[model samples]
Target chain A: MADAKERKILVAVDDGLESLYALSWSLHNLVSQTSNDTIILIYAKPPRTVNTSPDGYLFSPDMMASVDKCRNDLASSIIEKAKKICREQGDKEVKVEVIIESGDPRDVICQAADKIHADVLVMGSHGYGLIKRAFLGSVSNHCAQNVKCPVLIVKKPKSSSSATGTK
Target chain B: MADAKERKILVAVDDGLESLYALSWSLHNLVSQTSNDTIILIYAKPPRTVNTSPDGYLFSPDMMASVDKCRNDLASSIIEKAKKICREQGDKEVKVEVIIESGDPRDVICQAADKIHADVLVMGSHGYGLIKRAFLGSVSNHCAQNVKCPVLIVKKPKSSSSATGTK
Candidate 1:
């Protein structure tokens, strides 16, 4: 039997409504099922670009700082929104932590799950089919395969009107 | 660019309405988009249990045969049904095949994808949460993680009645 008191739930967030649905669903379905649990929201920063010079040098300090600031701002806003949602739906005693990591999204998520010993990973599938995903692989798929813990993939509901739309 | 003529699609089927939805969705979406694509329905047989006896180590022939028959019946029926749906939806040139292998469903699906060089994998997510999934591990998550190809997880819409019931 699982000890709800020790359960840790991790949600991987992307900039999309589907991810938001997953967050809300996690709070409603997973959190409501147990009185004692913790929810952690994670946002993975995009990779930093290095400009190569003729002499094999990278970007200067000023350029690096500007890029870092942009990443921090983006990560902070996402975490703030997730925190607001958790506060609204989470239990008073349930702990909620916001994690911002920089690296490949899938790698960051899997590393965090392992480091924290997460009980489960909750994420949403953005419905990228083979060809589209061939060029841009899915992070959710990567995390699901590599993580030792159980993973819950939330699928976005299909609209009855059309087969394709913004997920 | 994706060669609509050379795409191979793998559909994972189980004993659930959601699996049926996945099957239908794959045919409607993939077949309608391509005429050269091949659809393979791979059914992973349930694991067999071993029993020890005083006389000798004997296999459970009866149980094994029964399970095999059921799997064959399911694979054939689903393929026929899928083909019929494709024809009804005005896609008549798509080729479909059935494959039944015995092992873990996730492993079987991944192996089939690799063997066939599948372009995409289509499966269904039940949307079970952290605790429920902890108790009952999800096969969709397993496939998403292990398969090399992109996976499309179909979500069934929550009925309005069920939504109200929850509230």
Candidate 2:
């Protein structure tokens, strides 16, 4: 028997398609539609965006405003995308909440999960190899070690295995 | 409705308590005891043991044999422990398998999961912070990035939240 209270699942989302894949996977496999679960979709922007340029010069007020607006818009769009996926389920009893923060994703995600007391944290792997270590990636590694609750890192399914699990 | 075929779940376990906690968590949350699923428990030993002297100087052939025997014995003991956990479910239809490999755990785990075509890979997080980085840890991070299938890095339930999710 399932509990009456809602299960809070915090899913970390970004611009990558893998994030959406993780979203759909958790929606279908992990979330029990019969239960009143709350899906908290989170998006974290970099803290430096609000302050200065890459060269350490103080950002102009106009530039700062534009960057902030751009980040906010991106967060809203992704959260809307997640909302549309939830709507497809047609589970009217379920609730969805969106929270956008500005910080390093590795630390921000773990802090958000703890602050919200999330039941579980779900993430997506970017599949970067050793060569790509210089670029942005590896947050999942840090989050897995730091998050207090259970964390599920969903892989982007290959073409052949993509539609197989949905059925 | 659950599938009729068996689900191959490769769980990466170790001598740590987090591993058994992950084992029991999967048994309760992920494993469909009703389904004819196969659980493969895997443990990776370090590539080789360390010694102060040359390859064949300090570690004589007999001493090397004894060390290898001890490591194999530990692996067997852990496998037996995993089997006992499976037996507690009393799911006669469900099968349990054990594998022990010697290599870097990060690379070995992902390779094993792929070789077996595992439906899902389960891992336990030791929650080791930077201070403890000198020791072996963080294999789950690498496995999540490389493993083809979905990876569940289960966090050991905190004392206050341990009994909260059973329902």
Candidate 3:
């Protein structure tokens, strides 16, 4: 029934405290216990490097293999951490799906949200001050600009005594 | 009585379509019909200028009064528009309040949210890309970092079909 249908929420995740806090906030504030909500977790990685070797240098498959393995391991751990948080939240009706894409996050997040027809796209801000963000750029801001759905960029409360912090 | 508590939601509104859509989204998606939700609408205006005249002239009291009246009228219209939206939506339990503040938004917003002990602070993002935001800065971004509560920045969706129209 349409009244009982699940609301799909796409949340961008990384292995950071802010992202974890966002996930926590969603579980308590946004996610409904009986609504069978679907939460899509996405983590974006850089594209594979196949660039030409430096001058007088040759490509090394052995080194490349190790680098690939390291990257894969990190991705696995990060996804696992997110999965564990979802489980701990104990929302029996909520469904969580993990996706790891190779590309810039600014592009991947918007595309994924569009493909999923997400009700809302959630993320956590890095909270970089004015000067720092100018140089590094903000993925949440980019997703907000390009995505076709609503974007929620959660920031951790600045004080320990904040209402959000108590929860 | 405690269970039917009023949730303080501070929404920063402007003349932009994005901000209007944000107000719409909140009424539909965030505000609970069953609970008593208090919506605080804040409009930030530039501080009244008593600066030295550009042509090295003196300040005129009559000119200043007229300028202040113009600003006040503008603020009244914007707040009335927001209130009309709420009334049209017909959520009887929700209470709407209006506030007009002067000086820098980056500072005023965070301070107001803190003083209100707001449960959540909502606003609309202009969605400037990385380079533009770096040089120009963002009021919502700054409030997200400094406020003690969670911040929700709603961006106008890219497609015309979405509730929020593109620039």
Candidate 4:
């Protein structure tokens, strides 16, 4: 029965401790040790701007290539750290998949969830205040509203609740 | 050890299939059979309005009592149905608690979650569009941002993704 329905749980992670905390929570809470569930770890890198130069300064070809490599390296490191967390916290039998895409994190996460038909999408809340969240729209909020599957927004305990302002 | 920490999971339910679907999903995906997890089912009934007259017509004392009784009955029925679902879907060992409160759902849910220090808050998305959601704020969305704990917003499969409009 466990093998019959393999749930694909997509976890969006980043450098923030909040996202990593979410991944850990998912491992301990959602993924069953004996079940044939697949954990998909995704990191959305900032989109590369190899062609466009900020402040009208044209980038050399080598500079552009180096910048791209730097982003790729960061993405790989994040994924590796997430994988380690899964191995330590989750069952060994659970399959883990990795995805590194270059785009807005919100778009990348929602697209991947829909494309993979993920049973659930797990993410971390940035815990931004009303003014900040209004200025810099929350990625988790966007995905929660947009994603087809269930979206789990994990808030780190230390972060203050955003609703305090309303009260 | 599963016994070391028994998570308190708060699930807010209503008459809609969306909330019930969320409860079912939580039982299957979050609760471990062997763990001594407590599932708290909460239903927030619309606040009593016995004193308010809508059309300048005072409600008689008996009429107001009947109205209050009717709301109470509805709340009891909803809670009973939710309890039955928990018994059917969750493991027998898992503890179940029920709460029926009268107030704005957003406030009732957030306060209960905070008061109990729930490990996770589960809710169902109403699938309201932008205009509708704006006109009538989404309780789940409000709770997700306001609740201190992790929030799991389950979207019924048939409900169209709200992200499609922006796409």
Using lDDT as the measure, the top candidate is 4
- Reference-based TM-score of each model: 0.48, 0.76, 0.78, 0.87
* Residue range B118-144, candidate 1, lDDT tens digits: 766777675333454475478787677
Query: Which regions of candidate 4 fall more than 4 Å away from where they truly are?
Result: A1-5, A91-93, A127-136, A159-167, B1-5, B91-93, B127-136, B159-167
Candidate 2 deviant stretches above 4 angstroms: A1-6, A33-36, A46-69, A89-94, A127-137, A158-167, B1-6, B33-36, B47-65, B89-94, B127-137, B157-167
DockQ of each: 0.03, 0.33, 0.24, 0.44
lDDT of 1 by residue, A1-167 (tens): 11234567798876665666666656644553323567889887877745665699877988878878987897888778777777765434457888887777778899999899876677767623445447658767776667765566655444422211112
CAPRI quality of model 1: incorrect
By lDDT, the better pick of 2 and 3 is 2
**iRMSD of prediction 2:** 4.4
The fraction of reference interface contacts (C-alpha pairs within 8 A across chains A and B) present in each candidate is 0.00, 0.48, 0.23, 0.49
DockQ-superior candidate, 2 or 4 = 4
lDDT over C-alpha atoms for residue A43 of model 4 = 89
Candidate 3 residue lDDT tens string, B65-105: 78888888987898888888767653354689887898666
Interface RMSD of 3: 5.0
Q: What does candidate 4's lDDT look like per residue over B1-167, in tens digits?
A: 13335789899988776777788788777777545689999988877755768888888888889998998887788778777777776634568898888887889999999999888899888823345557659988899889988899988777543211110
lDDT per residue for candidate 2 within A28-105, as digits (tens), equals: 555653446788898887675338667989989998888879878877898888778766643243478988888777
Clash pairs detected, candidate 4? none
lDDT of 1: 0.63
